[model samples]
Target: MRKSSFMRISKSISLIIFLFVCNNLQAQNQSYSTNSKSDFWRNVQFGGGLGLGFGSGYTDISITPSAIYNFDQYFSLGLGAQYTYIKQKNNYASNLYGGSIIGLFNPINEIQLSVELEELRVNINLDGSNSNSQDFWNTGLFLGAGYRSGNVTIGARYNVLQDDSKNVYSDAFMPFVRVYF
Candidate 1:
């Protein structure tokens, strides 16, 4: 046989082996799913955050909703959406909308590690004038470790993309809470 023919045969064998391994792993996963009694809703979580603030000539409101899926005892993935509105005296206002992805890892009881990636569209009127509004996108990544008890999780995360001027967050460190249902 020619060198090219031998090479072709080797590539074909490698492809077959890769496909076989993938098929085997997928079959095992399917078996686990079929053997489990819990339905889809039983393995899912829903929770988020809400905020309201009122002060001198200013008011703020925020709402976030999230859903998560528990793949197993060790790891979970989630998605969330956020909306915030801020209004001040003299027609000043800002509106923000965004979405985020969350990942959690639990190595032991009551301890958790988390990472989040988010993007937001910020519309702001810097001088309280509706005629001069600006819009921009803000992206952030946060990493945290926390303790969980029952349905509540409390943790502190640091924003990896925090900027002194452009970012809206006052500081890099922020606290979070999650209630799963």
Candidate 2:
């Protein structure tokens, strides 16, 4: 009877030790996963760009002032406005105003995919030749992809709204560069 009692005590002690080891391993794995998720979203950022807008019968030099909001490492949204001088063959000059909303996706570290919806308008001088000046309005869309790293960004957009009344749409692939601050 004494030998049987001793064997039962040894089995109970071994079972307790095994349970303790398994619990510790599970806790360690859970902590590591939580830490990685925290590091992905702690960084916020901003930038500026300069490029050319060409379409129809008009080709203009433009400047883009931009800003961005980073919600996390995986996503961001941006806004930009562009201004340019429209130089025509008739020696008449006008001003162009444009705005855009940019969405960014981070698929890998130091790289991004950008999609944008851009709108533009041109102010024309109708009175320069007729003594009664008039203004012309033009609008269009641009869709493209971009790559970014550190403080520098570069991208190319395909012109989707290249057809307009004044032929003022940009029909070529537009490339741009940005500097983040």
Candidate with best lDDT:
1
Writing each residue's lDDT as its tens digit, candidate 2 over 1-181 gives 6988888987888788888888888888888877766654344355666667677666678778877777777788888888878666555677778888887777775676777777777676642575644465555556666687776767777667666446565354778665767
RMSD of each: 10.1, 11.9
- Which digits, one per residue and each the tens of the lDDT, describe model 1 over residues 41-148? 688999998999999999999999999999898898999999999988776788999999999998986998999999999998866466678788998999999899
**Number of colliding residue pairs in model 1:** 0
For candidate 2, the per-residue lDDT at 133 reads: 46
Native-referenced Cα lDDT, model 1: 0.89
Q: Specify the poorest-scoring 10-residue window by lDDT in model 1.
A: 125-134
Candidate 2 residue-pair clash tally: 6
**lDDT, residue 157, candidate 2:** 74
What candidate 2 gets wrong by more than 4 Å, as runs, is 1-44, 50-61, 88-90, 126-128, 131-134, 164-166
